[model samples]
Target: MMLCNESRKEAAGLTPFLTPRKTIRLATWNIRTMYEAGRTAQVAKEMKHYNTCLLGLSETRWLQTGQLRLTTGETLFTKKSKIKLNIIQCYAPTNDTDDEKKDAFYQQLPAVLDKAGKKYMAILMGDFNAKIGADNTGYNEVMGTQGLGYINENGERFADLCSLNQLVIGGSIFPHKRIHKATWRSPDHVTENQIDHICISKKFRRAWKDVKVMRGTDISSDHHLLMTAVRLHLKKFKNTTNMRTRYNVSVLKTKEVRTAFHLSLSNRFQPLQDQIENNDTNIETQWKLEARKEKKVVLNTSRTRAAKAKAQEDYTATDKEVKKNIRKDKRDHINNLAKQAEEAAGQGNLR
Candidate 1:
């Protein structure tokens, strides 16, 4: 019920949590196949803890399963937004051929790009099951000019896509030279290939800061997790850029951004006519003072309930069959911290 109510608010684009990033924080993770068990729950837990703005997951296996809804709903600020999850998971044709299967994958690339680009900047992140322009995949300087080669990227497919879409490739090439490089398969597993990948569009290239592949984590799966962070270069209008300018004590008297608070409060309370209304203030005043404290408690309760629920539910699960969701009890703890941080920083722009 709470999720539904909150979702309604979100659908209205009334997300009160998105603090216009002083900078953008984006991350991509190839959370092992969610359906396999606890993996989904663990990934959710991590994401909520980070409160990440932009998140991408790959090898999601979302095409066959409906697990994508859970991911898109909770991550996106609004409920109405389409599930913009960017992960490609499929069975590659195993003629022991990368080119044929890759061609099919590439054929679908345009549609994938179109679908994701409709919203905020899109990232074509997932397992391509293909290698890039490396390891002399048939000598060719023209391919490099055409953006189709890497030192160890055996084939031209990886290069072609990166060049075509201007997507920044996020991953490492060290394993490509070795006999085996695989995210979905390990020595313990049957297959081996570095198929998993994460890529971002040109628009989001500014946020392309850091990309790290988490090689060892007890994820119950043999595949290494890809943890990539992209810092979006958020631009803010400088009120004053001069550092030598004299500090004004009067500036503290100035107001900060007041869009949400003003609209919600004044729109509701301003029409309350007489300062001392018809009901008589003597009785109402006493109760108002008494209730103020309680009202605060309720608001605090709600905030804590929301944030803690997010954190606990995100990380508690140890099985893939069932999501170890955050507990409702811990929400207050998180909300209190958020409130404390807001007060300490004096940045109360919550909307």
Candidate 2:
């Protein structure tokens, strides 16, 4: 019931320490059943021998779904990340299973795919109990012409599911001998079929370099080990030095700091007063100038006391307005930075 990853030391867990751009071998096998004594150890030994980074298992026959760590240092049921590789391990109902159950299985699968999202490279693989044969007539987009046997009822359903999700059947795409293509052999060892499969999302179809049945592997099971070579490169880390600085604007809430900040602004304005009196500038520049030039012009040209007094009043109002605008701009900038920081945190980019 639980999908597992079997690997060597350092590679024993799932995606925690996977090297970027490295070729990882992923596989799926219906070990028929994993109830026998030391069956897990036997599978892990063959997995290490094949250098498989992650292996999806079917028919584990475990009573519950949860993490299980073996004494051999192998962990089961973990996740992957970044330009993430989402692997869904399945052990579908057989062809004889009721139609309602098969329909439910196919319906629930899309929900899982939706949870994974379209942005990731998803690999859906396992013992599907379906046989999509060599004829890629109607299901040309999702399969190839190199499959093992003729299409069955389960095959039609499987092919339709792959086409709906835009998944490419990896086992059917490459030219391999019938022995390499077949994933399951009958108990009598007389009949063989490629029921087990590994499928990759069509968008990342190129990442799947190759897929074939590893018949040499021995696990005392009827199913052969179906392995795929996948090239995965996680997105590189961004440089922290180039990130924007988050200023401490909380100090502005203190009266002393506000007064000091205003005092500093007033002192800085003293030097620009003369320049403003001599030049015509933009709106922002005029605001910074505090209408000093307009005041000076009125004083020099107007002879009436009433006109001079009115001009003086206008200049005082303009100065207050400029200070108010400056305060508003500062508050807006701080709020914008806080919003950005919240968004970054949500995206798991605290830096």
Evaluate all candidate structures by whole-model CA lDDT and list the values in order.
0.47, 0.80
Q: Please state the error at residue 22 of candidate 2 in Å.
A: 1.9
The top-ranked prediction according to TM-score is: 2
lDDT of 1 by residue, 1-351 (tens): 001224533434433322334543444445546577666566655555554544555545554422223543443221223343443322333225676665786678666666655345556554455545334333232122212223333234655656666665654422332322335565567655555566666566556555444544445655554445554465777787667867555644545534554677774664354333533224434454455555444445555677656544433322211211223224544565577568757865443
Once superposed on the true structure, which residue ranges of model 2 sit more than 4 Å away at CA? Answer: 1-20, 78-85, 233-351
TM-score of each: 0.44, 0.61
Candidate 2, residue 66: the lDDT equals 46
- Best candidate (score: lDDT): 2
1-351: candidate 2 lDDT, tens digit per residue: 122444433333335423445777889988877789888889878878888877898888777654567776566643332213478889899999999999999999888887878787888999999999999998899999999889998999999999999999998899998999999999999999999999998988877779988999998899999999988555569877866789899999999999999988885675367446734333574556656667667767877999888887877777777777667666765676689679879999654
Range of the 10 consecutive residues with the lowest summed lDDT in candidate 2: 1-10
lDDT of 2 at 179: 92
Using alpha carbons, what is the TM-score of model 1? 0.44
